[model samples]
Target: MKKILFIYFAIISLVLPQSQNESGYAFLKNGFTARNIAMGEFGAVGINDLSALHYNPSYLALNNKTQLAFSHHSLFNDYSSENFGFSFNLFNLPFAIGINTTKIDGIELRTKPGELIAKFNANYFYASLSSAYQIKNFYFGATIKYLYENIYIDDSNGYAFDFGFNYEKFYDNFSLGVVIKNIGNVNELKNIKTKLPLDFQIGINYNYKYDDFEFNPIIGYQNYLTDKISHLHFGTEIKYSQTVSLRLGYVSNYDSKNITTGLGVVFKKFNIDYAYVPIKYGLGDNHILTLIYNF
Candidate 1:
């Protein structure tokens, strides 16, 4: 089993982006689902079908069905990102996997003062495999990530690990989770001498149930360890009946565009999600659309 996993990971490494350089800014913008990004990237509880691989691996164990999700994002219609994720419970042991890519396409690497020198593309890709196991009131999980990147005359590649734990009371409305990412540099290549972008995060999710309606809120603190950038984020999912849902979120330090609005639907095994986020610094707004299926 371990060898198979290694082979699978090797294949993933071949296609991913190495987000390492003299400075590690590319690691900061590596992609994930926009639903999470809209919430200022606060994804700790992350029980959502698609984000299990990135945020909380324990969510895979809680689900018995298989899930697949894809997203399209427009960052002001110029630079954009595309993502895909899949997760399933295999052999009664939960497993999850994901793939994401960010392409800064349509930008000309200009000379001084807006003169076009040459066309360039800086892309980063991440592929991950994760698993979770249940133990009493807690679930412990881990993820292995493969990264790859190629830029103008410079290329680097590496691997990292993530660990997560979640605890929930059976009859309570509260849950907690903690996750740590970027554990080791399993395969460090040349010219990339820095450690991976590391992060530690804590999350809280609550659902207040009532006769007519229920409100679900999620709050989290994320600390990027290597950079010392700390942030707080929160979101609420308000639902009416079994059909329609609304979402809003806030994050303190991501940008001026902190608020988020989202719409959701559940129709048997099919789900559709949409999020609209306003601008922080640019002239255009951003939107993300996602579709998911669980079976």
Candidate 2:
């Protein structure tokens, strides 16, 4: 059973989403919030969103209120993820924390084509602590993360870091951001070490207002160091009265999925967001929902 489980995990580590079979811990590449997902997973150049703790921590410097956020992501093949985020201030400095837990269940163990011997589950988790400092209109931030993964009876632990910079003084309606992410290493899992997905990303965005509606368009470039691949992210959002938003996004250079759409609603101190992505090859679809409250 252990040997089979090891083989299963080896295969899984190679085929997880967004990494193109080149790196492990692919779950780290997923979007942190539904709004971000709806906007093509644009992590940089965020505006006061606590989810920045996962993408570009430098954006956390924009936070002036205490906020809490929760999200659930449903993927194909009985895979799911739960996430939590919190942001607050201490001594006039902004800080945020994030947690993610993912599970893949009902994995079958069979010795023959028509026979099933047993079923098991695989789990992954990561926790992060982040903080940002602002100097004039420039923000700098860093994040430290602890990662863990369990497959049947074998488990490994790891650590990583993310650093980010944001320039918001260029214009009132424009912002630019850059980040370096997943800089660390993981322990060996069954005598084989898994490689982290190291990445560098840069993004720009513009906000425009007309009458009672506002428009935001964003573009980003991402480079995966390990996979030697590059991708482009594009997204736009239209908001009415600052209460309701319609979002559309597209990500280039993916084999399984690309286009995404979603919406957001703001009610007093609470916000609700949803995102949907249709996968190809009959692999079902991806759905994400997030709720946030500010105090």
Candidate 3:
């Protein structure tokens, strides 16, 4: 019995990953997008008009006026999250500023001695300040983030950066965007040094609008520098009557990914959107609800 206990302790000590400088436990995709993880981080091609800061800061540049949005997600049976953002323009300037945050609502934590400690309340909390500048059809922006998290006994705090650009030309029916995220790391864990979940993404969107119908198609790729994970996603959105919208999307990379579908409705200056993510496995099925007030 003593031999078995010693062996177990040895294994747990190595696997506990109590230091930030360690390499195995890695900072991963702990962000706030239900569609992002389910649809392969493909939100750079958003079908709705809220909280585009997840994929590209430049996407929020379209807010000609102040806009605020909130989203809630049931990430599984026990884990959940909430996302909120607000963006606005200034006078006739070509600059914009936005605030974005994602909070991990509930995570249970227990002591290593097998005693139940306290719940994490939030396993991860991230707040970002984003800004953009546009010249003609070209827009560029970036985000600075503050992160705080406590996972079990291993805690890490870090800063991350994101930069992105969007451009369109010719008939203005085609668009392309590029975004790079999490290129820096300043982990305040047990004094070890590591990196963020560095990534690069490029996307294209095209659409046609008429009196009665609007159709949009989007494609994007994300390359994760940490683990060299590259993924592709494709999606389309359709709108009719100018009040209702539907979305369909696909992702490539995993053995099986979710089929993303969503519904949206507009009433005067307010927009309500809901996304259904058909994810099984550890994530289970997820439903996201969003509210946006546009001015």
Candidate 4:
């Protein structure tokens, strides 16, 4: 038992971030869509949905249909985000594009009691171009992004890159994936400079089939360069037929809510998904709604 504990701690020590405030653009760490958020943000691998543009671009190689996806995230403290993504295949290769914007409003700016001054808002925008190719059982992918952030009258912009790879044997029901994200930093507020929330993640997925029911389970680990903690994520989805699914997920080494659940419904080429997450400490809960169209 002692030996196992030591090994676990050693792995954590190697993966955890060195400091909490070491990076900027923290919002980039937020999950992309309702389905991913429902899966406890275990997006390092699996399923290869359109949202893979934000997680593991290598999964793009698995795309068999063109898709467009949109998501709305309702967060606490008057903050919210809107995400849009599209994935398609051209010349036997897959490409994905996405944009995300987060905003916070309703601030009370006052210079004196009972006196209202001016209200201000902050916004963050991210745009990305991603593509993936496969050679036999190995898949490779890359993404390039431009990030812009503004607060009041001040704004800044930067660029970043992500690289990913996936390996699967044609006859196997399991796959492994790895990715490195946010390979660049940002310069904000003229004199303030900070690093992006760089992360390294690795994960695997297993698929089990029992008659007409299908089950997918995923396990992953993520290391952030900006904090002193590592994340362990687990996700599972049970599917009945071609139109319905239930998803459950859990995340360890988190400061807020760690469990997530979601529902998915598909009709023809359209899909709808919803996720419910209860925040800890009564801060507030989060609700994510997503719609996907496949062609």
On TM-score, the candidate that comes out on top is 2
**TM-score of the candidate numbered 2?**
0.93
Q: On residues 156-180, what C-alpha lDDT tens digit does candidate 1 reach at each position?
A: 6678788888887544878888888
RMSD of each: 8.1, 3.0, 5.3, 8.7
Candidate 3 C-alpha lDDT tens digits along 42-87: 7554423545566677766654457777778765555566777776
lDDT of each: 0.69, 0.85, 0.62, 0.80
Worst 10 residues of 4 by lDDT: 1-10
- Tell how far residue 48 is off in model 1, in angstroms: 3.4
Clashes of 3: 2
Q: Pick the candidate with the highest lDDT.
A: 2
Higher-lDDT candidate among 3 and 4? 4
The alpha-carbon deviation from the true structure for residue 154 of candidate 1, after best TM-score superposition, in angstroms, is: 2.0
Evaluated at residue 33, the lDDT of candidate 4 is 84
Model 2 lDDT per residue over 1-295, tens place: 1224334645455434334447878788888889889888777775558988998999888665579999999987588999999999998888898999998777776655665668888789999999999998899999999999987677888899999999984888788999999999888776666788898999998988999999989999999887788999999899999999999999999999899899999999999999999899877799999999988
Candidate 3 versus the native: TM-score?
0.79
- C-alpha lDDT (0 to 100) for residue 11 of candidate 1: 26
lDDT of 3 at 224: 73
